[model samples]
Target: MARTGALLRQAPLTVALAVVALVVGVVTGSLWSPLAGRPLRADLAFGLPSLEQGRWWTPATGAVLALEPVQYLPILVGLLALGGFAEVRLGTGRYATALVASHLVGVLGTAGLLALARGHGYGYADGLARQTDAGMSAGFLGAAAAATATLRPPWRGRVRVLLAAYPLVSLAHVGALFDVEHTLAVLFGLALGPVLLGRRPHLAWRQLTRRDYRLLASGLFVLAAVEGLVTAVAPGGGPLFATLSVQQKHEELANADTLLGASIQAVLWLWLARSLYKGRRVAWRWAVALVGLAMLAQVAGLVYLAVRHLPGWPAGLYELLGNGIGLAALVVGRRAFRNPSRRRARRTAGSLLSPAHEDQRAAATELLQHEGTVNRLAWMTTWPENRWFTDQRSTGYVAYRVHAGVALGLCDPVAAREADREQLLGAFADTAHAAGLVPCLFTVTAETARHALAHGWHALQVAEEAVIDLPRLEFTGKAWQDVRTALNQAAKLGITFRVGPLSEQPRGLQLQVKAISSEWVEDKGLPEMGFTLGGVDEALDPQVRVGLAVDADSTVHGLTSWMPICAPGGGAPVGWTLDVMRRLPGGFRYSMEFLIASACMAFRGEGATTVSLSGAPLARAAPPGGAAETGGSDVAQEPGPDRNALDAFLDRLGQTLEPYYGFRSLQAFKTKFQPRFEPLYLVFPDEAALPRIGLVLSRAYLPDAGVRDLVTLARSGH
Candidate 1:
């Protein structure tokens, strides 16, 4: 019942149409059997005869029939899965527009093709004109194709290639009249993809899915290979889609000119295409080699045909053209070959903490210790999974990664003076652009966002950092009543909050904290997130300080860690940013509040001016009854579905983690202390690059995550 409800809500138009079709099919003799025993087959199913006889409604009504019982289940599944998902992604009204528009074009198109074919006395066309075609698959395929625009790349592109190939593959094998209609229908669907996706992909598409450049090359590569199949099967050769002829037995090249050999090559194209889409270096190398060989063989065949006689001149020319196009495509898109595998990123991650990075780290440390950083999240600058980019002046550095053409800055730049920010940001952006990448700053504070905005970067509020002004701190207000009580109860339970570097902690105590952190991760049902977020290993960084809540038995109940916001001129730390916040399962409920309060007082005693509760990802940044971010934030400013895809994705992501992380709840807990709200923003060039930036940021944060880990994360809750 729930699943059915989901289907209706997702694709009301499709579900309604399918239900109507089933109802009509039950009454008409053409579908399954006639429930009403009516001789309605003549009026419903589409054919040239039916159209000529003026049964003009047949194109739409014809889809009501299952046509063949064996196909019914597949048609139903495709309609539900592809159509429903597209409708959900693209919205019901736009989905309907694509489906109806595609259907009308297909009906008129097939009619035109059949007429031309019949006039030419082609048996295939005459047979198709007389043959009845019925199904909603054409419309389904169209909607699915158009909806690819809503997906993130390289998936967006991969799905488009697969969908485009599906109907073409069917037409080649089946050679049925409706197969031709289905093939043409997909083109219309793809043509309307920009309208459905909200804008033209244009250069932006190439920029976003840099790894998918091979898809274009491989598509043409397969086209060149298909000519070989055509030459092997038919004597009159052209491109792959030329007229089908009787299979002929060829001389000399025994195995190479056989159907079995062509089939093997076709399967190899599939493997090569999949590999190329995944950015496998081996696949790119293989494609280049095979395309070279195929082009040479095609030239030889063309020369042989011309030398033997000009009998196959035109067809042979087309075959040569096809092979040339394939070779040219591979050469053009060669640089699009990015990663050998997902693991390639790990090998090239450039660990900030590694021996190989010592000189760079030492250099950066000296610079940062002198310049200091304003953004508390700047401490993530030292995370092992980062690549540093410094300007020529060496006054500041941006820790970043180039993933899928997106140069994602982990946080704000660490600079000696805030005044140097705009110049540094411009340099960073210019550097990224010079390298052919889109520059974006992720999980950065408002201070950095404003700076980037001054340099023409757009900002979107992502989360808010909770800052406790330690010099003016007090727990006497009504808002801090709950926090005070939690502290008192924690003292009664013998849960004392202890703070220090984990590396210098007692060995026995370190082991307990490790166990607690491990358990917390396993329970989250997802791979531990990195980049700005800290894990057990990150908590042990020599400079980071950890606070643990333990009882008399030294059993750890909860822990919090802080990363320093180095003081200006590299004098000393002026503030600390909360990093690792974890509590063991079944531990004291109030342990977190207790630990946070204790850390605040301890940091204050150490002469720290501020203690920052780091911003929560994808969580609201504003106080209750206010906008998310202070400067020009309106939550309802862009409420339409057209402008909400990124927000929708962010909302879903937040919900998925909310069950375990309770970031919103954590924010609420912070508000009880009357802390100042510091907004964070995702700074990028503009909306066109948001999706690509999103992908780059997700990968940077969760490098070790896989499909199963994400699935598990979605299913688990605290």
Candidate 2:
């Protein structure tokens, strides 16, 4: 019931029109000669035929031409009902155009099909050979098809029901109850309707399959079947009108016995219309009047045809005027019924775009600027380094630089170290990991490494430090051969080697630093160590020495800074630490080795006995004794063989990673100096605290956490 009501509401006008058509059809038969065919001669042109013989048109032509105009009256009513309702829903002009176009196309298609059929070897060719006519049944079916296309959701099923009914009607005709051509014309109209009408509004499939729709469709199907069967079985001829000359016995049966059936159809159509109108809140008076007017026009047209037997002009003109008037009324009603609130909405939208809103631009701009700043700051720790901060002209107060692609504080390293260097480093590492940037620390001092362990920094062995007896060892023999070979290559390439202070370096020399203590230990994946570079100033301190390797063009190729090692009992100044080293472009041959040799010589000149080339900054090793604490004969305990094994493995890794990271290559290159390997121990605040460091490191480096940071930390000498 709800579904039927909804459908009726959606297409009230169509329902009303269908009812009017039925009423007109039944009334026409009652008022005019029951046996007579179509009222208008033009209808013959549309496949209808006159009863008169020798009319220039052939017998088949006359038969095919003949349309049971009564049958189409209901269809036209359906079209009008659907059209008006659709117009109400989709605007008057669109609805009107869709209906008219569909009808026109449907009619033309039917005519073309008839022509084609006649041209082909169908039996109709012999009968309709001389006839070339057209009719509006095709147009009516087309309108119905159009309605089907435009109807939405709950109403769609109703449209589908009507569409299905069209073919069934055609089948009834083919079953010998009615003319097959007429049925074909109606179906052709219906099939073309959707094409002309275009698409209906979109709705969910479930909405279209309601209970009332099923009930109504079932009832209609049963009714149509009963009508078909009655017409099929009923005999022809009636005593009330012996003078009548019916074309078929079925026509006589329809005229004599189907009055009650026709009346019932008319009543159902009216009920559908009334239900639709009521649901839509359309004024009952207007609906009633409109229906009455349509009925009157249909009656007037029928009466004129019955009395005058007028030519084509009267019937055509009457139909044209009547349809035009009906369309006008529909248009007026639609305009009057439009929602005022929708108009107000358009006005409001227009107001927003007006010049009065121009002042809001400033506020919008401020909001955008704030958002951009917040987003930038939020993502600041994400990269290895802040590329944006490198630009001196950058406006924001926040600035950063990548120390080997790891983001670190520029001015707050001390604060970070105090608060928790490990946490800060972890944040930086996490940010870098997320951004796919490599997180690394270069030239980090022992103190910083300790701080990293305290906060949680993992280490892996990359290379051994090559401490040389500066005063005793000479750069000669097999060692000299290697140095000479490197020098000769450098000489041919016009490369030079030079040493310089931090202030006297060429523009090609690049400098970077890692704080010994800062809130950056979390990324290192090792417990923190208490170490601080807060008191050390590399540029001004006399205890520190900076070494440079440059090419012939005076371009710095590599550099290493050295500082005195702190020891007890009046420090002996036994070795100079390689605080920093870098390879400059176009540097001297054996630049790295040369830099170490030169630094060793300078330290010897300074009365130093030995040089601490420095442990590989990145190195790690597994615990000794085959993953267990007990020392066994099976495990070679040659001063922690497990540590040596891990170092050896990292040495291989350094060889592999050398080409990619220059620092890794430097670590490997330093091996030729034959410095003693040392084990670097990470002293965490507590052993149980390692997992926290590991978690932060995992989030920061994921799969590479253990391999890069932990391995490097574990292999480094304490």
Candidate 3:
């Protein structure tokens, strides 16, 4: 009640309008009846006839009342909801201006258009000329549409879609005179919104990612389904239906079987839409086939009409236009729909993973057993989502995923022999090119970068790998004071560290660890990152080891997962790479430090040679003896002729993502361990692909992030 009162106070215009509407409804019996019915309607309602008869007052008078009492419900609700939102966004004065301007324009423009076409013998326009409407919906809809410009995505996109879709769908399905007015009102509002906000009328459209393409295609299918269902059920001579010739209209309304068929088609389209949204290749193929048949049928009908000397164009021209759009989208975005059905996915892994192999994940795991120790990030190639690209001799392979037309290889290619490594890089690139994909390698070690650079590929340092020699690891110096303090503090609090498989932990303890991870993810404005980053699912791998910081009460304070670093020739694990660090918000202030310190000591006890703190993307430690700042200001520039726009972009990107992912902060945190920083590079063949590579990399890391998330990141840059 308090919130409602506050909202009403903020939107006095909306509140006042609602009050006026209610008062008018009560004063005039026309609210329950047909608004003075036939004779007086021309004088009391807003339409061409009323305006032609010099009833200028009808426009203003009709705006406050509904033609029917039940219709008042939706009209009043629309005013309060949409009008209130516009008032809040545009403020009362601007909202009033937008509303009044839009209402008059919609009323006058619609009436003028109907007057011009009234004697043209066009069924839709002539039919509307005799009708009248009385409601505030058109004005409020326009105001809401205009207000949409002030909103940030995905709300901005969402509100605009709703405002646009409502009038268009209503006009097609119902075709009342007010529907035309509503449509005009919304269009005017969209144009007025940015002007009112002091922004340019031009919109800055963001580049769509693969996921976005899938979602858009899915939405188109859903819209088609809705239109079909509405046309079938309502059976009205709407804007869409009125486009049909008399004979075509007779065929449509001839039998119940046609309506049933339309209903079934709608249901089928809806089912396919769900799968398309998930990027199912099967659904894409089905939709393509269906729309292709539709287009072909339309063309055939057009030919028949021409041959028979028909008076009008073929029926369902609007449907043909929609089909053409759906077909174009299905073809243009074909790459986005890569996920096969479940059974096919099980047989082929991903669509491009390993066609002949039953499970590429197992193959990747087997290969990793031989060459995983090539780099700290090598084990990540064995993740379930990766596709394998084998070398000519099948002695080496690159683990990659196709995103935004780029075949992004993760870390170094896995090979049992050193000579096979360089060959694998060229082989992967050649294979990607043969398949018409841009090829790039991310987070590769210096050796792989050198190999690629030797082949004329460009390399840009993207991260710094932190390696701690465990044999020399000690907490004796002042630099180690923080680590020691954390260990001691945790010990004092009865907190103990355990290193093992997370799955082996007590069920309750495992749940707590997951909860801790979830809490960390939820606290961030963006989605949990993937690609090189490991999460709870990866930490649950039996081959990986997990470190837990727990109290005597069995409550877990924090946790970390360490991917195995195996030696060449499938030898025993020589070290561990740090991944998946998460802590409870207020459980222990120094839980992370305690976990890392304990993990290092434990791995050292196990005779492990080294421990990798992993790499912080878009961040690097200061050059040896350079600066004391956590993120060096001079770190943006690298000493090379190749340092150009891409470098500046990376530097800016690192700073932009700092608040969301804390890459620089993590880099600074790793510095406390006195670890050596090794440069990790992103290697690609052409500099022209840098822009695309940048977008793909962002998508790779944040696959689940939507337009709203990207917009938030852009705003954070400011």
Task: Identify the runs in model 2 with alpha carbons over 4 angstroms from their true place.
Answer: 1-464, 487-500, 504-543, 551-553, 570-572, 620-664, 695-718
**For candidate 3, what is the lDDT?**
0.81
Predicted structure 2, TM vs. truth: 0.27
TM-score ranking from best candidate downward: 1, 3, 2
Which 10 consecutive positions of candidate 1 have the poorest summed lDDT?
Answer: 627-636
Per-candidate TM-scores read: 0.71, 0.27, 0.56
Worst 10 residues of 2 by lDDT: 373-382
- Top candidate (lDDT): 3
Q: Following a full C-alpha superposition, what root-mean-square deviation does model 2 have from the true structure?
A: 30.2
Clashing residue pairs in candidate 1 are 371-416
The global C-alpha lDDT for each of the candidates, from Candidate 1 onward, is: 0.71, 0.40, 0.81
For TM-score, candidate 2 versus 3, the one ahead is: 3
Give candidate 3 regions above 4 Å deviation.
Answer: 1-12, 27-44, 84-93, 151-162, 199-220, 243-250, 256-258, 274-289, 295-315, 328-340, 349-718
Better of 2 and 3 by lDDT: 3
Per-residue alpha-carbon lDDT of candidate 1 for residues 144-221, written as tens digits (9 for 90 to 100): 888888765445766777787766655653466667777877888888878766686453422433433555765665
- Candidate 2 lDDT over 618-694, as tens digits, reads 33322222221211212112232213434454355444333333335454555555444343322222222233333
